[model samples]
Structure formats: structure tokens, C-alpha cells
Target chain A: MSKVTTAANQFAARRGFNQIANRLFTGIVWLIGICTIVFICGLLFLILKKGLPELDWSFLYGLPSEMEEGGGIGPLIFNSFYVLVISLVISIPLGMAAGIYLAEFAPATKFIAFIRICVEGLASVPSIIFGLFGIALFVEALDIGLTIIGGAVSLAFLNLPVLTRVTEESIKAVPKELKHASFALGSTHLQTIRRVLIPVALNGIITGICLTAGRAFGESAVIILTAGVSSSGEMWDFSLYSPGATLAVHLWYVQSEAIVPDAQLIAEKSAAVLVFVVLLINIVFRVPLWLNERKTR
Target chain B: MQSVASQTLIDIHKLNLYYGQFHALKDVTMDIPEKAITAFIGPSGCGKSTLLRTLNRMNDMIPGTRIEGKVAIGGADIYSKEVDVETLRKKVGMVFQQPNPFPKSIYDNIAYGPRLHGIRGKQKLDEIVETSLRSAALWDEVKDYLKRSALSFSGGQQQRLCIARAIAVNPDILLMDEATSALDPISTLKIEELAQELKDKYTIVMVTHNMHQAARVSNQTVFFLNGEVVEFAETEKLFSNPRDQRTEDYISGRFG
Candidate 1:
């Protein structure tokens, strides 16, 4: 009878220990989640509180002044968009084609494996290193100086690896059965990729583009090195060879070395706009994926 | 069914296939009659599907795959250097075990093949889509929802739609690789009936694991074992009184 009582006590102790462990794990997980939420919320609140008061129509549409207290970011915004367009136009076709060749056409050889490893290494390299490379290649060697084309070309180099990797993964995710069906229906290799493969992988490709666009939008190091830290002449001057300062670079300049008294205010508003645009891009890309899931269900 | 009067549509002569060093098909030889359903039956890994894929050179897509000897369809050698694989495949369409409809509108899925073949006019595409769907007996079910995504259909309907898509190209032969195995019994029966009707117009070659399915639908049945043809005879004779001892054992459920 004594032995039986001892066994029962041990069993009860083990069950109690298990319950405590489960509760501890649950609490730790919840704490991590809550901490992340709190951190993001706090950051957003601080930025909005400091920036929203200065965000007026004139701040958006007005010209920047060298000596005055009130200055606008109109030319900076235009230059940012113009550089983005040039980069995308250069990178999208080349990246997607390279991705297709790697994913579908290239045989598994030692050389191919080496190429893959190089691409992965390039993807992990710092953006600052790309800035240095851009200065060496475009600004100095090519005699382009600090121009919009130089900056856009540098940004294209930065975007290529990301777009290539995304395209490769998306193309690889397409079902093998679909390819077989296309071939059995008498489609040539190129025809099958054009008609079936691209359409299916389009969603993932768009997501990749949005990701690259967001990264390029907030990029300052490469733009500063290649496009310079200042713009001259009229607000709408769109020459490819002219030096341009993008919004992110302008924010950095305003905070550190602007002669204007309201530099801090301009920096805060620019930060807000940058963050908001990135969030909007993410939402725009994700909505299609969500709608596709809903429709299939 | 083997009365020696029907013209041979596909003639395989001493066919041997290999994937790298592994021999997959061993000296396969068979004569498929025109306008008839020929069913291939065996246990798993028996190379029945491999042989079906070889008919249209689908095995060419695999790396390090090699084929020796001859495969002729309608007295023309398909493996010759002069023969274009794409044109060969156009004459021999295939359906897979799983129903694989493109993630597009029903009308677009049906029109995909014709469009690839350069059928661009809207009215011509509309006529072909309707005719193909009608031939596969899926017209009335999906006539109202031509614009709806093909993924929205039931499994059976999707399979039939795939059949319609295959037929839209108007191929002379159809190869089905265990096409009904993934469907329900009712869907399987419908497909079996559809195959029977299709044989009147197109030469049908099907690979199936189901012995009953082979007995029920095919005019000629070929049994495979270990990458070789064990027996090839009329369906009734092969089931009722298989000449080979191994065929008898397999049909009697003694072994795989």
C-alpha cells in the first residue's frame, strides 16, 4: 500500500511539471510576438508624431531653397522616380532571361554550380561595395561623372541578383506535369516557356519586382556615390546626364549638413513618406496573391 | 480483333530504352492497329508508361536518356534525324494521370493548343472550342462558364476538359498514362465510356494498373513485367485464357 501511494505521488508530480513547462513555453512565445508588435508600433508612432505636422502641399510641390527656412523635395522626388524607371527597364529583361536559362536550360555541371555560387555570394555583398564598384566603373572609368545614368546603372546592378533569384525560384515552382502537357500538345521548348511557364510564375515575379523597387527607393549609398548629393536648375529638368539627388539622399543631407533652418523638419517628413510608400508597395503586391488564394478556394 | 486486315498505325521494332546506365525498356516490339484502343497493364515500375512516353519522344526531355532501334507511326520513322519532334508530337497527343488544366479560363485552356498552331481569329477559336468540348462530352456542363477559371471545376470535369484540350489540336492519336486512376468510380466509368467513343475517331493507347480496366475497355491488351512485354494479345483471349504461365499467374492474382 505504501509503494502504490509513492507511485501515484510520482505520477502526479510528473503531470504537474509537464503543465508548468507547457505554460512557460506558451508565455515565452507570446512575449516575443508582443515585443515585436510593440517595437514596430513605437517606431511608427515616433516618426508620425514628428513628421505629420510638416507634411503640407507646399512641402510636396514647392522648390528647395538654399537659404530659406521652407524648402520642398519636388526635384528630389522626380529624380528618384526617373532613376527607378531606368533601373527597372535595364534589369527586368536581362535578369528574367538569365533566371530562365539557369532554372530550365543550364545543365548541372561544375561550371553551372560555380556560377550559382557566385550569384549567391554577390547577393549577400554589401550595397556599399556596389557603390564603390559603381564609382570605379561608371563615374571614373566611363567618364560619366555624377549623372542620373550612372546612378540608374548602379541600381540596376544591385537589383539584378534579387530579380534573378526570384525568377529562378518561381519558375522552378511550376509543376513538371504542366511542361509535359505542353510538350505533348506539340509546343516547342521556347513556346512552352512563353505560353505556359511565364503566365504561371508571373505573380512571384511581380512580388520580386516590388521588393527590388522598395529596396531601390530607400537606397542612399549608391545614389550618393553615383548621382551626387545635389540637383541644380529647374524642378522638372529631366536630362539623363544631369546630377540628381533622390529623396533618401536628400533626407540624409538635410539631417547632416543642410544650411536651411527647417532641415530637421524636411528630413522627418521625407522619412515618413519613404516608409509609407514601401508599405503601400508591399500591400499592392500581396493583394493579388491573397485574391488568387480566395478564388481557388 | 487481330484479323490481319486493319492497317498498323504504330510499329515498334526491337525497341530498347535506357536512362543513363539503367535499362528501362528491353527489346519491346508491338504493332498497334489504327482506330483501336490498346491498353498496357502491369505492376509498378514495369516501364508501361515509359513506352507510352516514347511514342511521342517525350522521353527526350529527360537527361541522359537513350533509345535504340525503331519506332514508326504511319510507316514514317519518328526517331530519324529529319523528323522534327514538335511535328511528331502534334500527331500524337497525350493525357496525364492527374488532370492538368492550365490556370486560365475554360475557353482559354481549350484555345491554347489552336493558338499555338496559329489559329488566331476569334470566331474560328470559338467554333473549335465548342466542337472539342462537345466531343469530350463536357460542353453542356461548362458552356455557360467559358470565362470561369478551369481550376474551379470538379476533378472529373477537369479531366474531361483536359481531354477536350488535347483534342482541340486534332491529333491523329491519343496516349493516356493512367488517366482515370485519380478519379472516382463514376468518373472512371465516364472516362472509360468516353475512351470507347474516342477510339472510333482516334487511335488510343492507354497505360493502366487496373486489370479490370484493361479487360473492360481495350480491344488489345499488353501485359508488361520487369521492363519487358510478357504478352500482347486480344483483350478477351488475354483475360480468358492467357497462353503464358506468368500471365495466367498475374491475371489469377497469384503475383504482381
Candidate 2:
């Protein structure tokens, strides 16, 4: 009877072990799912709590008065848009071409492999280093001074490595059969890329661009060094010689060092507005992909 | 059928292809009659697909591939020194086994071939898109939403769209490499029917593992084994009474 009881207990132990393992598996899945939802909610709640109350058209468009008077971030906003656009114009084509070479045309060789390693290294280097390089090359050597061109050029370098990697990955994600189909239809290599490959990968590439743009827009350390702190409240400027202070730099300057009576309010308002604008830009950029996903479904 | 009988579409002579040191195709020779179906049936790696790809110079795009042969469409040697591969391909279109429609709208996928050859006007493009879709037997199901993404279609419809894309350029010959292999039986039947309808206007050469498919669609059948032609005869004759025992073994499913 004792031996029979031992066998029965062992069977029960085995069943208990399976039950515990199964419960653990399901618990982990639920934990991940719940954590993701909670994190997203936390982000949205914090941004809204700090940002929504301060936003107004007057605050966005009004010119800055003296240090004591409450002023707007109009000049900083204009400068941010200008620098972001110019930087994109410079970096996008070059990075995309490099990606195409690496993905489509590059032979499997040690030299090509070395170049890929270098690009990966470039992506990991800190933004401060890029800022220093820009100051040395564009600001001092090129005699560009502290201006928008120097800052835009710096941002372009910062964006290139990331954009190139993204472009290559997106292009690679396109099925091989699509290229073969295009070729069999008598389209040349260039034609196939333009008509088939690019269109298919457009969503992924655009997402990469949006992320890069966000980085450039919010960067403080890089822009403060390359572009001067001085900003004029003009919305339109074609010349690249003007001094510009983007919104991020403005928030940093006001909060840390400005001795004005309204500096505290300005910091709070600027932080709020800045967060809102960034969120707005990200949502606007992602709208196309969201609609596309729905249509495909 | 009336206009097709007068034109000699494709003439291949003494063809050989190699991948590095491995010989893929061995001295293949054949004449593809105009606007008729010629099917290549063989075991796997018998070089049927390789020979089919050579007709449109699709092999040129592959790396480390070499060919020693003559493939001419409309009496122009496609592999000659002065010949342009792009133009040659334009005249000899191809459809693949997997349904490979462009990641674009149904209309844009069909219109891509004609657009590249400088068919710019929207009205002319619309006409070509419609006619091509109709020829491929996909127009009625897809006519309402030409702007919809091509990937939204079923597997069979997507294969038909590929055929429409190929034919929209008005090529002299169409090459299909197991074009219906990835599709279901009903889809395969529709595509085969489309192939029959297309032969009245375009010459077609197909490579298929399915002997029944080749028998049902092709007027002529070329049997190959171990990179050599075992027998070449009318489709009925080749299936009913194969001269080569190797061909008999392959058709009987002894071994691939």
C-alpha cells in the first residue's frame, strides 16, 4: 500500500508540473500585452497633462518681446521647419543611392563588407561628435559662420547613416519575384526600381524619414553648436546664411540660463508646445501608412 | 488564328547554357510556331526553365551565367552583338510560376509595361489596361476598382494580372515557366483557358511539371531528361506513345 501511494503521488507531481508550466507561459504573454498597453497610455497621458493647456494660435505666431515680457516661439518654429527641410533635401538622395548600391548592385566582397561595417559604426557615434565635426569643417574651415547652412549640413550627416540603412532594409524587404517580373516585362533595372521597388517600399522609407526628421527637429546640442542662438521671427527665408534657433534649443536656453522674470512660464509653455508639435508631426507622417494598411485589409 | 499562321515567331538553334562549370542545357534546338502553344515537359533540373528564360534573355540578369547558342525572335538574333536586351525583352514577354503582380493598384500593374515603352496618354493607357485585363479573363471581377491594390485579389486573379501585365505591351512571344504551379485547380483552369484564348494573338512557350497541363494546353510537346531532349512530337503523340523509355518513366512518375 505504501509503494502504491508513492507511485500515485509521483503521477500527481508530474501533472502539477505541467499545470505550473502552462500557467507560466500564459502569464508571460498576458504580462507583455498588458505592459505594452500601459506604457503607451502612460506616454499619452503625460504628454497631454503637460502640453494641451498651453497651446494657442497667438502663442505660436506672436513675436518675442524683451526678456521680461511673455513672448512666442514663432522664430524658433520657422527655423526648425527650414533646417529640417534643407537637411532632408541634402541627405535623402545620397543616402538612398548608397542603399541601392549596397543592396542591389554590390558584389559580395570584403571591401563591400567593410563599407557596411563602417556605416553601422557611423550610426552609433554620438550626436555631439557630429556637432563637433560640423563646427570644425563647415563653421570654421568653410568660413560659413554660425548659420542655418552649417546646422543643416550637420543634421544631414547625422541623418545619412540611419537613412541609408533604412533604405537598404526596405528595398531588401521587397520580394525578389517582383524584380524578376518587372525584368521579364522588358523594364530596365532603373525602370524596375522606379516603377516597382520604390513604390512598394515607399511606406517603410517614409517612416524612416519621419524618424530622422523628428531627431533633427528636437536636437539641442547639435544645433546650439552649429547654428547660432540668435533667431529672427521671419517665416520665409531662402538664404542659408541666417541664424536660427529651433524650438528644442529655445526650451533649453529658457529653462537653464535665462534670467528673465517670465522665463519659468516660457519654459513650461515651450515644453508643452514642443511635445504637442512633435506628436502632431509623428501622427501626420504615419497617417498614410495607417490608411494604406486599412485599404489592403 | 488567321493572322498568326503567316508569321514565324521564335527560332532557337543549338542552344547550350552553363552555370559556372555545370552545364545546364545541352544543345537544345527547336522552332516555336507562331501564335501556337509549345510546352516543355521534363523532370526537375532538366533545363526546361533555363531554356524558356533564354528566349527573352532573362538569363542575362543572373550572375555567373553563360550561354552558347542562338535565340532569335522574328529572325533577329537576340544574343547578337548589336541586339539590345531591353528591346528584345519588350518583344518577348514572360510570366513566372509564382503570381508576381507589382505592389501597385490593379490598373497601374497592368499599365506599367505600356507606360515604359512611352504610352503616356491616359485614354490610350486605359484602353490597353482594359483590353489586357479582358484578354487575361480578369476584367469583369476587377473592372470596378482599378485603383484598388493588386494584392487584394485572390491568388488566381493575381496570376491573371501578371499575364495582363505581360500582354499589355503586345509582345510577339510569351514565355510561361510553370505559371500556374502556385495556383489552385480552379485558378489553373482559368489560366489555361486564358492561355488558349491568348494563342490566337501571341505565340506561347511554356515549361510545366504537370504532364496533364502540357497535354491539355500545348499543340507541341518537347520531352527532356538529364539536360537532353528525349523526344519532341505533337502533344497527343508524345503523351500517348513516348519513344524514349526515360520519357515514359518520367510521365509515369517513377522518379523525378
Candidate 3:
């Protein structure tokens, strides 16, 4: 009787230890989760606290002044959107096609594997290098000094590898059975890609496009080297030859140069706008994914 | 082993199939008759499913698969240079073991094959969709929800939807690669009955793991072991009095 009681006590003691350990582990995970939420909330609060008061119409739509106090970011905003749209137009279709070719048509030879490695390597190359290449090609060789076309083209080059990798991975993620089903139903290679592969992979591809677009919009280093730090001072300048200074570049200049008394305000509001626009891009792209999910569910 | 050559819809002569260096199917020969249900039964890795895929050239999708000898269906060698793979696939529709319905609506899944053949009229497509689903015995269950996503259906219903999609193209041969292996027994019975009914029109060739399934539904049965044919005979005779000892042992649960 004493032996059995001792054994029971030992088992109960071990169970007690396990319960305490489990509680500790759960507490640590909850702590991490709370920290992440607090950090994001604090960052958004800081930006919007100083910025939201200055987001009036004149500050947003008025012209930038070199020496004056109340300059608007109208032209810079236009240039930012123009550059993003142009780069996306150049990159998306080409990158998606290259991805499809790699995933479906390319044979699984050593050479193809080598090509895939190179693509991954290219995706990781620093964005500054592309900016330098743009300067060399457009500004130096072509003698077109720091223009919108150079900046947009360089941004497109930076977007290409990332887009290609995303598209290829998403296409490959589709179940092989789906492709087989399509083929068994008499679809040719091209037909299967158009009807089945693209539709199924659409969500991932859209997410990729949004990420790249948001990154391209907030990019300053490439624009600094290729498109200069000043806009053409026209709110509606459509000419590719004109200098294209995006809102991000303008924010950088105002923060560092501090030429006007309102520079601090401009920088603060610009940061808010940048973060807000990026969030908008993600949400907008996600709408379609939500619709797709509902259908499948 | 052979069925009557004159009535054969699928004629195989000394067939061999290799995956890279691995010989998946050896020099096997058989003839499957038209408008009859034929079953290929064997253990896993016995090349039975591979043989079914060969009918529609689905094996061509694999990277390094190789085939030799003859697989002539309807008097045409499918491996001939002039044969269009897409056309061959159209004439020989396949249903896989796991139901694979596209993420589209039920109507769209059934309409996909017909749409590929340029049937653009709304009325004609609707007609095809209804009849195909009806023939597959899924119309009564899904008729009200044609716009619902195919993924929303139960597994058995989705398998039926796949069958409906396959027949929408109006093929002469229906290849079922273990079509009911992934289903519950009730769903399996439904598909078995459908197969029997379909044999009056389409030449049905199936690969199955269940020996009783072979005996119950098939007109003829082919037993394979290690990529070679062990026996081929009428289903009833094969079950009751298998000619080869290997076939007898397999059916009587002596060894696989």
C-alpha cells in the first residue's frame, strides 16, 4: 500500500511540472503577440498624430515652393503614380510569361536548374545597382539627363525578377492533378495555361503585383540617381523627357534639406501618405482574392 | 491473352513502357472489346494505371517516359507521328481516382470541354451541361445549384461532376484510373452502376485495386504482376476457375 501511494505521488508530481511548463510556454507566445501589436499601433500613431492635421487640400494639391512656406505636393504625387503605373505596365505581362515558360515548358535539365538559380540570384541584387545601370544607359549613353523614362525603366527592371519568381512559384504550387485533368479533357498546352493555370494562380500573382507596386512607389534611391530630386513643377507633365520626382524623393529632400519653414510638416504628411497608400494597395488586391475564396468555399 | 480480335476496340501487341531506365510495363499483349467494360487489376506499381493513362497519351506529360510496340485504338496506332495528342485525348476522356474539379462553378466545369471545341452558343452549352450531368446521375442533386463552385460539392458528387465533365466532350473511350478508389463504398457502388450503364455506348477501361470490383462489374478481367500480364479471361471464369496458378493465388489471397 505504501509502495503504490509513493508511485501515485510521483505521477502526480510529474503532471504538476508539465502543467506549469505549458502555462509558461503559452505566456511567452502571448507576450510576443502583444509586443507585435503594440509596436505597429505605436508606429501608426506617431505618423498620423503629426501628419493628419496638415492633410488639408492646399497642402496636398498646391505647388511646391523653394523659398516660400506653404508648398503643396501635387506634382510629386502625380509623378509617383505615373512612374508606378508605367513600370507595372512594362513588367507584369512579361514577367508572368517568363514564369509560365519556366514552370510549364522548360525541361527539367541541369541547364534549366542553372537558369532558375540565376533568376533567384538576380532577384536578390541590390536596387541601387539597377539605378546605376539606368544612369549609365539613359543619362550617360543616351544623353538624356535624369528623366522620367529612365526612372520608370529602371524600376521595371528591378520589379522583373521578383515578379518572375512569384509567378513561377505560384504556378508550380498548383496541383499537378489539376493540370492533368485539363489535359485529359483535350486542352492543348496553351489552352491549359490560359484557362486553368492562370485562374488558379491569380491570387498569388495579384498579391505579388501589389507588393512590387507598393515597393516601387516608396522607392527613393533609384529615383534619386535616375529621375533627379525635383519635379518639372507642372502638375500635369506627361512628357517622358521631364524630370520625375516622386513623393518619396520629395519627402527625403524636405527632411534633409529643410529649405522651407514647412519642411517638417511636408515630411510628416508624406510619410503618412506613403504608408497609407501601401496599405490601400494590399487591401485593394485582396478584394479579388476574397471573392475567389468565397467561390471556392 | 486476348478477346476476339475482330471486336477489339483497343489492340495491344507486345507493348513495353519505360520510365527513364525503369521498365514499368514489359512485353504484355491484350485486346479489349468495344462497348464492354474491361478491368485491369493488380497490386500497386504493377503498371495497370500506367496502361490506362496510355490510352489517352496522358503519359506524355511526364518528363522521361518512353513507350514501344503497338497501342492501336479503333485501328489507329496512337503513337503515330501524325496523331494529334489533343484530338486523341478528346476521343478518350479520363477520370482520375481523386476527383479533380476545377475551382469554377459546376456548370462551367461541365462546359469546359465543349467550350474548347468552340461551342459558343449559350443554349447549346446549357443543353450539353444538363444532359451530361443527367447521364452521370448528378443532375437531380445539382441542377438547382449550377452556379455553385464545384469545390463546394461532396467528394462523391465531385467525382460524378468530373465524370460529367469528361463525357461532355462526347468521347468514344472512357478511361477510369481507379476512379472509385478514393470514395466510400456507397459512392463506389454508384460509380460502378454508372460504368455498367455507360458500357452500352462507350468502351470503358478501368484500373482497380479491388478484386471483387473487377469480378462484379467487368465483362473481362486482366491480372498483372510486376509489369507483365498473368491472366486475361472472362470475368466470371477468372474469379471461379483461374487458369494460371498465379492468378488463382492472387484471387484466393495466397499472395499478391
**What TM-score would you give candidate 1 relative to the actual structure?**
0.94
**Model 1 chain A, TM-score vs. native:** 0.89
After superposition, candidate 1 runs with Cα above 4 Å error:
A1-27, A283-297, B1-4
- For all candidates in order, the CA lDDT equals 0.90, 0.86, 0.91
Ranking by TM-score: 3, 1, 2
- Report the poorest 10 consecutive residues by lDDT, candidate 2 chain A: A6-15
TM-score of each: 0.94, 0.90, 0.96
- A251 in model 1: Cα distance from truth in Å? 0.7
Output the worst ten-in-a-row residue range by lDDT, candidate 3 chain B. Answer: B1-10
Docking class of 1: medium
True-vs-predicted CA distance for residue A122, candidate 2, Å = 1.4
lDDT string for model 2 (A28-58, tens) is 9999999999998897677667656866787
Which lDDT tens digits does candidate 3 get at residues A157-198?
999989999999999999999999999999988999999998
Deviating ranges (above 4 Å) for candidate 3: A1-21, B1-6
- Weakest 10 consecutive residues, lDDT, candidate 1 chain B? B1-10
The interface RMSD values of the models, given in order, are: 2.3, 1.9, 1.1
Clashes of each: 0, 0, 0
RMSD of candidates 1 onward, in order: 3.2, 3.9, 2.3
- Which CAPRI tier for candidate 3? medium
lDDT of 3 by residue, B1-256 (tens): 2354538889999999999999999998999999899999988899999988889999998878999999999999999999999999999999999999999999999999999888999999999999999989999999999999999889999999999999999999999999999999999999999998998889999999999999889989999999999999889889999999999999988876
